[model samples]
Target: MERPSLKSWAEAAPRLVAVAAGRDTADLVIRQGIWVNVQSRELLPGHDIAIAEGRIAYVGPDASHCIGDKTKVIEAEGRYMLPGLCDGHMHVESGMLTPAEFARAVIPHGTTSMFTDPHEIANVLGLEGVRLMHDEALLQPVNIFTQMPSCAPSAPGLETTGFEITPEDVSQAMQWPGIIGLGEMMNFPGVIGADPKMLAEIAATQNAGKTVGGHYASPDLGPAFHAYAAGGPADDHEGTQEADAIARVRQGMRAMLRLGSAWYDVESQITAVTEKGLDPRNFIICTDDCHSGTLVNEGHMNRAYRHAVACGCDPLVALQMMTINTAAHFGLERELGSIAPGRRADIILSSDFHALSVETVIARGQVVAENGTITVDCPHLDWPDHARSTVHLGKTLGAADFEIPAPAGANGVRVRVIGVVENQAPTRALSADLPVVEGLIEAEGAVCQIALVERHRATGAVTNAFVEGFGYEGRMAMASTVAHDSHHMIVVGTSRADMALAANRLGEVGGGVVFFADGVEQALVELPIAGLMSDDKAETVAAKAEALGAAMEAAGCKLNNAYMQHSLLALVVIPELRISDKGLVDVTKFETTELVEKVLQ
Candidate 1:
């Protein structure tokens, strides 16, 4: 399908003037709605909106004079005419669905705009993959802007990607129509250290006059954070605390508090606005990584808005965070993100501010979704064979591949474990001592085996380590190619045999997520697109994901959205400890370290 084109303000200005002056009929008109002017932060009741050429032409107390017999008008019935919600920063592949499918799932939730980072696919298929995502995103009826992935490996030396993204790639992607800006710059160390290549990538984006996304994962509000702020990143979404949010906004960076499937950073950081009385304009709300279940069962940006209201934030402030604030952060204030004249006619009809029951969603002057159902078709791209065939594990594996060898004649070993914190991106660098049996350290109780398999190059290398916090019982293992930063295979299991089986099964079917327990395959979600995203419908993938959740619960693992937690084990950028293709990464230190702390004789 050709990219959906809407007239720019320059092209529609003549008609807009005619329509507003009551000399011409609007393409669409909405009557008697509470106009939510996000720019002025005011909710004016009883107004009409006139749209022409897919752009808002008039919004006032009445647009009756602008209506013709050909015009399509809807009675808002005193609903709040909110500017459509815009997600400032998100990964479309995180939902395990392609861009088209992801849009199909979120349109009903009043999400009319998205700024997606397709770095997950870039890790697997390079620039071509990013182009593929960019192309499909433009085809959607709703706005889905693609940020040129700035980090493929995410952390340059910490891990290796299937394909590395270069400065040339960044410069070239900047010219693409859908390429809004560079994706999150996860290499904070490189930025502060003034790594030339990292600086060059930022330079390319800056030279192109686009927003440079940020990802400062550290909690240090010291000079390091200040240096990173000065390094040209315009916004950051890795903030987890009130201080982190406060520090970022004070430094002229938009503090994006995200509420994803497993991340609950919004509530903690929202207090900066609610309590300290900081300006809400510099604070944004986004979903950094929302899975399909969250989009389908709960909501999208609307979910984040509701979560903020529940966090004691004023409803209008929350709406601003979800709408105008996000658009302004991306430098798209004049184009979209509001119901004002000269903007894209993307608006939502909601009856209540507190409950925000989205009754209708309009995108580009078209009714895209209504009453929890999509009314428009989100176009799909024909994915090539190379895109689907990404999983390339070198050889078959066995239980030996996951074994951590004990030190010479040691009875017990102190291991640096990747501690899983429930519902947060950062992990704790905890240590645990376990007994060794026959020259191998075995997983005991809460401590399970975590292995990073080299699926990118088919190098047949497996880095073994231990992780705690997921209290799993019996023989079970889960394998996923949706590992963050690097699209490698991460398997966590009690039984090594089950881990091996799950990994092999995913490798057999291209790529996806799978669960195994008691020597039987329990659940699987096939993501054939770059092993990171599925071409199937969002509902289909969500259903499969639900079964996988059931399997996780059956194995006695009871962390909220444990699958999301499982996928981030290989995310080396977020501190404090994470497993990678090279070795155990101490993110706080920004170097590879030993898995074992010491050996007990």
Candidate 2:
């Protein structure tokens, strides 16, 4: 299908204005509402909205003159009429659903626009993956713009991916329809060092007059951070502190605070606006990564709004962060971000601003959702066979495959461990001394074994390492195919037998999450689509995910959102320690580390 051209929308403006002025009739009229004008930050009561040809023709005191006998009328009944919410940065694949299903899940929550980066898929399928996500996004009723993925391997030499994206790929994608801008450049070090590939991608985005998204995961706000900002990323969502937020805005970059399924970054960062009294216009709210469970059980943008309100942010200011600020950041202010004349007629009606309970949703002059239920069609794409058959475990494995050998004749050994920080993406690089038994090193107290099983190729290779902070107490193990970026298999367990069972179970069911105890499979969430997402509805996936969480708790692992930590074990971009198919990685130094030291007792 051909994309609707901006020229067509421009040419229809005169006829649209005539309909607004009562000289002509409109297709739809929304009557008697309190308009929450975001531009002026005022609420005007007893206002009516007139729509013609899927564009807002008039927004004023009365639209009765423009309402013809054939025009459909929607009675707002004194509700607050506001612009539909926009997610400034997110990953649609993170929802564990296709773009169509993701839109269906969020529409009732009053989210009409999203800026998505499909880099997760790009890591697996390259440009074909990006085009698939982009094409499906344009087919939705609401606006789902795609930001051409900037980094595929995310970090070039840090880890290997099923496919590698080149600078040529980035430049070509910028010209595609629905291409908003470059995706988040996760290669902060590369940008700071002026790596040719990273710089070229940024230059292409700038030359195309589009936004360059940023992701600086380090806590350092020093010279490296400054250099990354100078490398040309327009916005960043990796800020986890008030200072991080303040610094970004002070440097003329939009600070995006995210509240995803497991990432609780908004509370810590919103203080930049609520208490520090910084200009709220430079801030935006987003859900960087929300799984199917969160989208189905909790709301999407509505959840972010409520969280902002809970953080002591004013209701209007919170709305602005999710709506106007986001639209303006992507250069879509005039086209969207408000319920005013000439903007796309994407609006939401709610009884209260504080609670943000969306009673109805209007998009492109049509009612799409009402009272927590989607009332319109969101078409799904037919995923090809190649997408489904992606999980490749090189060989079948047994318990012996997971054994970690200690240095010869060593009584004790010092081991580097990856520490899982609760509700945050960054992990702690910790080292611990442990006793060795029979030349085999075992995870003794809070530490457990973490293995990255190569699944992309039938390599059946397991790179073993140690991880802390999960608080696991017994002979249990957990396995998941949701490893970030590469989406490989990650298994963490105290017992080798249980670990083997959990790993093989995922291979059996194609891909998803599994938990095992005492060599018995306890729980599983079957995500058959691309081994990354589930074809089941979000509610169904949520129920299975809830069961998986309960199984984790039952197995003696206690940590807030430990499943999120499990999913990121293979994400080599974040600092400290991570396991890839090659070996254990010291991400802080960006070098491969040896599993065992050459020493003897």
Candidate 3:
């Protein structure tokens, strides 16, 4: 389908002008609403909005003159009329559902706009994957804008992806319709060092006059951080501390504090606004990654808004952060973010600003959702069979594939382990002394074995390592093909046999997550779409995901949302230690490191 040109506003101008001038009737008129003006930061009562051609024609004290016999009228009954919420940064794939299903899940939560990064699919299917996500996004009932994926492998040399994205790919995607800007540049080191490829991508987005999303995972607020900020990323969502949030905004970049399902960074960072007295315009709220379960049970941007309010942020300030503040960051303030002339008629009705009960949701002058239920269709693209059949594990594996050999004649060995930090992306590079049984290292205590199975090239390569946390004690294993950047299969377990079973189960089902315990399959969630997302409804996927979480708990793993931590075990860009297809990676040094180091007495 051909995209609507920028002259759409011009085309709708006659109808809008007619309605505003009281010469013609509006398609819809919402009367007597308490306007929560995010742009002006004011609460004005007795406001009536006139809508025509799916755009706001006029918003003022009264629209009684614009009402006609055919005009559909909605009495707000003294409800707060708010602009539809906008997500400044997120990954649609992380929802474990297609863009259509993700929109279905969040529309009722009053989210009408999203700026999504499709780098997860890019790692598996390259530019073609990104285009698929983009096309589907445009078909949604709400405004779902795509950002050209800036990183496929995410970190060059540190990891390998099934497909590599080139600088030309970035340039070409910038021209694609509905592409807001370049996606988050996860390769911060590459940007700081002025790598040609990274700079070329950044230049392409800038040349197109678009925003550049950022992801600086490091906690360092030093020279490297400043250099990355200078490398042309307009906004960042990886800030986990108040200082991190303050520094980004101070440097003229939007500090996006995320509150995803597993990532709880908003509480720590929102203090920058409440206590530090920084200008709230440069701050944004987002969910970097939310699973299907979170979207179904809690909320989307609404959840983030509520969390911010609970953290002592003023309700109006938090709403602005999610609405106009986000829209302005993407250079879309006039086109969206408010109920004003020429803006898309995307608005929400809430009974209380503090409670945030989204009673009614309006998108493009039509009621799309009301009272936690979607009213409009979220169209889907025809995802071909080839896209579903993405799992390619060169050959079948056995228990031998997930084994770690100890040094010769060593009774006990000290091994580098990836320590899982609860509710955070970065892991700790920890060392543990473990028992060696017949030259084979065994994780008998708090440490467990982790392996990265190469599914991209089907090389039958399995990089074995150890991981702390999760507190697994029984004979069980969990496997998933949702490993970040590379999209490889990650298997973590106490028993090698169960680990092999879990990995092979995913390979058999094309790609998804599998949990096994005591020689029996405990639970499974099938994600046939690039092993990252499911075509199934978000609710269905969430149910299965809840079961998988239960299975993890049954295996003695005691971590909140442990599946999220399991899926990111192979993310080599963030922090201390990660497993890759090649070997164990020490992310701090960005080098492959040995598994075991000799400890002398």
RMSD of 1: 0.9
Task: Please give the lDDT score at residue 596 for candidate 1.
Answer: 81
Worst 10-residue lDDT window for candidate 1 reads 1-10
Ranking by lDDT: 1, 3, 2
Model 3 off-target regions past 4 Å? 2-7, 599-601
Best by lDDT: 1
Off by over 4 Å in 1: none
Candidate 2 to truth, TM: 0.97
Give the range where candidate 3 is weakest over 10 consecutive residues by summed lDDT: 1-10
Q: For candidate 1, lDDT tens digit of each residue in 1-601?
A: 3468798899999999999999999999999999988888899999999999999999999999999999999999898999999999999999999999999999999999999999999999999999999999999999999999988778887899989999999999999998899999999999999989889999999999999999999988999999999999999999989999999999999999999999999999999999999999999999989999989999998889889999999999999998899888888899998888899999999998788889899999999999999999989999999898999999999988988889889999989998999999989999998999999998897899999999988998999999999899999999999999897999999999999999999999999999999989999999989999988889989999999999999999999999999999999899999999999999989899998899987
2 or 3, greater by TM-score: 3
TM-score of each: 0.99, 0.97, 0.98
Candidates 1 and 2: which is better by TM-score? 1
RMSD of each: 0.9, 1.7, 1.3
Backbone clashes, each candidate: 0, 4, 1
